[model samples]
Target chain A: MNAATTTRRESIGQSPRALPNTSSVPPRSLPNDEQRLLARLRQSDEQAFDELVTKHHGALIRMAMGHVGDREVAEEVVQDTWMAVIESLDRFEGRSSLRTWIFGIMIHKAKDRGVREKRHTTFSDFETFDEEQEDAVDPSRFHRSGEWAGHWAFPPQPWDDQTPERLLASQQAVQAMNRAIEALPVTLKDVLILRDVEGVEAKQVCDILQITETNLYVRLHRARERVRRAVETYLEGCQRAV
Target chain B: MAHDASQSVHEEITCREVVEWTSAYLDAHVGEDRKQQIALHLAACAGCGAYVGQIASVRDLVRLLPQTVDSPSESEQVRQAVAAKLRRQ
Candidate 1:
């Protein structure tokens, strides 16, 4: 096996079980640290609150930006979310993880703000994409009717010596990925941001977005494919210039 | 039509299917039976192998990219606001 394939295998081995049978498993409880943090926050401990905000603020802003389309507005939405969290802290039932609850509140506020601004598309607006009908990768990349039907007609060229560090090192490539992510429909964008960008677990992402695991995977794949396509296009352009 | 026997043997799962399942496969979400099919296919098909590897790279790289940053002053402003609100309550 090639080095890339070996790496892929090892990575898969290390992955958390992505699709747990939620029905069979008990609902997740707050981790002890979160429980202690909640207790401290309830006691009006400024340090605890500060740590909470610091931990989640950047991701909240990024996620809100995906919905509100303005950094300032996104920041405001997150601020409002923090305010809501404080107001509702005593009422928090621990039905979900604290992070999930916090994110859920931010998404609610961001979507409302997004609607008021009318600059950003809401999740309902994504109905037009028809998730069932859309193929994440371009169909033309696959072969037509033949023994090789459904095989790659135009397979992606392996990126030479590509590593995350190498990919991020390229200013143009980074911009390409950022643009691609920004252009995604909000539904796709939410899953990517929550699951990949923010490192939220698969199950919590579903809770935050009110989506099923199946829905999460579908949207996540499509989102990643778009970013991958952006990088591929950028690399192809670089090759052509060379 | 002549084809490589090694490639043909593993064509039970198509490249299109593998591409679609790439994310789930990388996350180890697929069923064992289907996972074996994909693994067998990837072992033989360099195209699918490259495609999956790129998608994996993209997934890992995205979180490492510089995300939206709140200026230190802005963050402090937020902290102060939250602190004040907590004090009031």
Candidate 2:
């Protein structure tokens, strides 16, 4: 093989996909295209900035929506995030990517908005988080007539078919999730949303939240567990109907 | 009341350990040791197991929900508004 071909093959083998997955890779940096665009953006290239905004605005909007749950509020949050990105351009140290930088801004803006609205649903009641209550599941409530041991032994059934009804059921489940998330303490909710829902890495969550890795994991663990408990109880009711 | 609070606190396991092991148990993250630890703990501790099961259920439920995020209609509106505002600057 030619030297160029051999070199290309070696490079591909050394890429990120070849590496073992670990939390070492920090989140936020410029993708090649984004880096190029940022250079142009620094020059005040309007088209480049426009393209960047178009590509990312939708995602930012949805992220805002998740935090606040109101369309208008979400739109405003994204708007403010963009404004912050523009205003802070001079200070952009390129420590994280422009996207991460913008998201950091958006998260703060959305959370601040959430606090300001102070309008929350009844879902935040502390009584609902009582993990002890889950143990009260009545054996009689389940159709345990069959071998209880065998029942426990069997794997959980795969989800049923995709249908409109299934879709609605799932939406209800997500609503339950959102409510559960909304009920979490602000710090926990931020970690859970950024790490779990947004699929950001652990390192990124820690960076965005300005928390140590240990503290980040602690908050994430508690937040995730709380959301799990709430969603489980919600689904348990749905299971009864099936 | 004192007894109940103490028992509940005593019952609490390391949230970090559980969270660390859960991804492995769920097969999203891999490591036999973690899965084993989580499985063994779950077997011994029903409450933590229930909590684990709840997380798995929530992920499954998200699959059933509608794709509501970043709907094209709303997205375009926001895009135009932001673009206009950016242009003004």
Candidate 3:
């Protein structure tokens, strides 16, 4: 599904709520690529920092945007992430890629933001919804017609030869999927986000998360299942309506 | 044959085994025997396989979401904000 429909912007021209899509951009890996850039950045090279920011700004924004769901808030988070990165460069031990380091800081910032947001207002409890059996209502009870499954065959994938109209519809589904992903438990959310969205390798996720490979996999596996169910349930609802 | 859902611990995957397999599986480092075991379990166990598939979809969905690019000027706002902080440090 196109990601735009599920992600509504506060304004017509404003950026939509960001989904954590990092794999397409490879900055999360390549420790050496980062090292070279950091070397220049450390020398007080304003241009170097500018280059780094320009290259990474969108991904970072998207990253923060996923956590906060607001463009202005996400923008601030990215700025804070860069500031934190600059301040901590000297302490960076080349243990992980610069991207990971920056992201770690961003996650912390995002979590902090989440805590504040939680205290200010209550968010809807999606758990009750999750608990409801997806097919429990027995789609047949309502329609009395042929099953909806025949009309639907796994919505065309995002990269498929989708029409502009179809793509737009798909984007909405993706946006809803993003919300479900965000609602996942932190442990599962982090593992899935890092492994799937960011496209970090299993080894990198383990290193960055400081968890054993075994633990990471279990979390990843379980997390993936949750997100998939969430996405499937969402699409199923849309299909039934059609 | 499907293992009895009400079977004892001995009849089901132990917590330790699940942990061990999960670790190896994450690293893509599981051996053939354990791999087969996991695959068999996953294939027969809709719940477990659904778990694996969800993560896969999440990963794929995240990868496929189109990036929301902003103007260069928006980035400059970040640069300017950080530059002041950088000067102090």
Candidate 4:
């Protein structure tokens, strides 16, 4: 009945746990093939385990690398993640695809290991960013107010190679892009690898990374922009060589 | 204050806002009304239009590229190791 007690109870009612599950994201469906694999995995089928590892191992290692930023530690994380996956097979419901669920576990384990190793930078650990600051573009392009205000001052440089845009997907360019992706900061790299590289659904990525859709959007755009710059640089160098 | 991209900046969405919404738009996650706003902005804003086009191509290039960006193979040994580890569990 006291004033302080009443206020405390009201605050608790407004806490995140008290909030309704109003997330717009829908859980990804487990494909029929994935269900069969999940069943086999639960029964400890060796072939099923091997197949899953073969499919996911490389991407998982790259994902772990994003968390730990070290090859050896990342490998260890992947190994530990596989162990966890195997042990928890029986507990998996068909809610999300097996891959997303596995990533959910991997990210959690990776975060813990990264934190212990002093590399896990949660949101509070870093400064906030204006997701659309246009840092790469010149400020003089836009005027204060007019018909053209808040619009492009000039056309952006063509991202495609001058030689031939099709050649942008050539082996050399992909190799350059790969290096660029590897060099990105952890969060950016994570979003890029998962959503862009592995082609996971954005909703699934949000779940795995435990970030809001907005945060994922920013990370993905920045990550893609960074890789595009690297590719553009490579193409320009190639042009110069010719 | 206004709803048109051709009109004054009373209620125009900035280039910055478009950039912020770029990924989500590409993912088809933005609402229909906001999607229309972006389309209007792109129609009128050449700079933002080019920016959007370039970023979209980057996404296309990425999709065309291989899945694994580094150490492109998951090596037979690694798979075997994982299987063995799981077997022991």
Write candidate 1's Cα lDDT for B22-53 as tens digits.
Answer: 88889887766677778999999999999999
Name the candidate, 1 or 3, with the larger TM-score value: 1
Which segments of candidate 2 are over 4 A away from where they belong? A1-29, A40-74, A110-169, B1-74
Quote model 1's iRMS.
Answer: 4.0
Question: Per-residue alpha-carbon lDDT of model 4 for A63-164, expressed as tens digits?
Answer: 787777667788878777777776555545445667777776777677778777664445433223465564534456555578757556654565434433
TM-scores for all candidates: the values are: 0.83, 0.56, 0.58, 0.75
Residue pairs with colliding backbones in model 1 are: none
Give a tens-digit lDDT track for model 3, residues B6-40: 33333344222332244345445665555556665
Off by over 4 Å in 4: A1-29, A119-147, A159-169, A238-242, B1-10, B67-74
In candidate 1, how many Å is residue A201 off? 1.4
Lowest summed lDDT across 10 adjacent residues in model 1 chain A is found at A2-11
Among these predictions, the greatest lDDT belongs to 1
Q: What's the C-alpha lDDT at position A193 in model 3?
A: 63
Q: C-alpha displacement of A47 in model 4, angstroms?
A: 2.0
lDDT of 2 by residue, B34-85 (tens): 4445566577655456546655655454334433455666656655665675
Question: What is the interface root-mean-square deviation of candidate 2?
Answer: 8.1
lDDT of 4 at A39: 66
